[model samples]
Target: MTQPGIDAADAASPRRIRIRTCVATRERHSDEKLLRVVVDPEDFTGRRLLADPKRRLPGRGAWITPQLSALETAEKRRAFPRALRLSTAVDTGHVRTYLAELADGPDIVRKTEH
Candidate 1:
């Protein structure tokens, strides 16, 4: 039975969780701080792929920009596991591989040709 005045359609919609990830950039002022990424995906493909920023990975998610410097900073600061709230250490190689795939994306390669 539906509640009085409450729309059934609205109740059926899945609830969304938003997670924010901060990534550092190469630029001194603009990229030095943190890059905030919002995770709103219902699946892990997006977060796992790193190619699409729409879908987020399952469990706790961490955000870091597609820059070597930023990745280094995160590693040095132990930001990945911290963001994920996991006491166990996360593999840096995994993050590197993910970013490598993103860097090899069509857009990035195209921009490099110029």
Candidate 2:
């Protein structure tokens, strides 16, 4: 059975979860638990990668686990170009800086879960 205006397929489908895959880990996770980045086209030298903490950039984006190791792994594997559908390498310095800012997120590394 379906609603008057809805297609049967639409009515039977489950609510979608916003999941994304981490380029470094090759794992799927909630977007909220991952970080997103995109290649900046206006850099004029080489493509520059930018972290989208707010997830607001306008072009194709890639997701990764929020760790410096993960970021470095992705960079080392040349995942950004494939993930973002670009033809060349991107400058990762900007994204690295962003990760540094959020490094260790909370001050308490032992028990403060907030």
Candidate 3:
């Protein structure tokens, strides 16, 4: 059960939902409906992007709706670099692969729903 005031909504709110805005669509969505993209942890150049479904990666992150169209729009409009405050060219290859897997792999287990 939630404390009296925390996440208060008649005490029936199981948890406070995190809302994030999509850089691509300029729309607000709950974290559950968004995909977070961050600079790859292993890349110091800060140019390569990684799609973080788990939302656990460290660094500046940009949220986008988890859809192919949204991804394409963000990439086409070059929103990541601006949102991430990066001056270098941003690459989305890794994130593309992750989204592809999500589209094709029904067996894939998503872990951050809660």
lDDT tens per residue, model 2, 8-46:
888888677799999999999999999999877566754
Models 1 onward score TM values of 0.46, 0.73, 0.79
lDDT of model number 2: 0.87
Best by lDDT: 3
Best by TM-score: 3
The runs of at least 3 residues in candidate 1 whose Cα sits more than 4 Å from the true structure, single-residue gaps closed, are: 1-54, 105-114
Work out how many backbone clashes candidate 3 has.
0
* TM-score head-to-head 2 vs 3, winner: 3
CA lDDT of 72 in candidate 1? 83
Scored by lDDT, model 1 comes in at 0.51
Per-residue lDDT of candidate 3, residues 23-56 (tens digit): 9999999999999999988987879999989999
Better of 2 and 3 by lDDT: 3
How much is the lDDT of residue 64 in candidate 1? 63
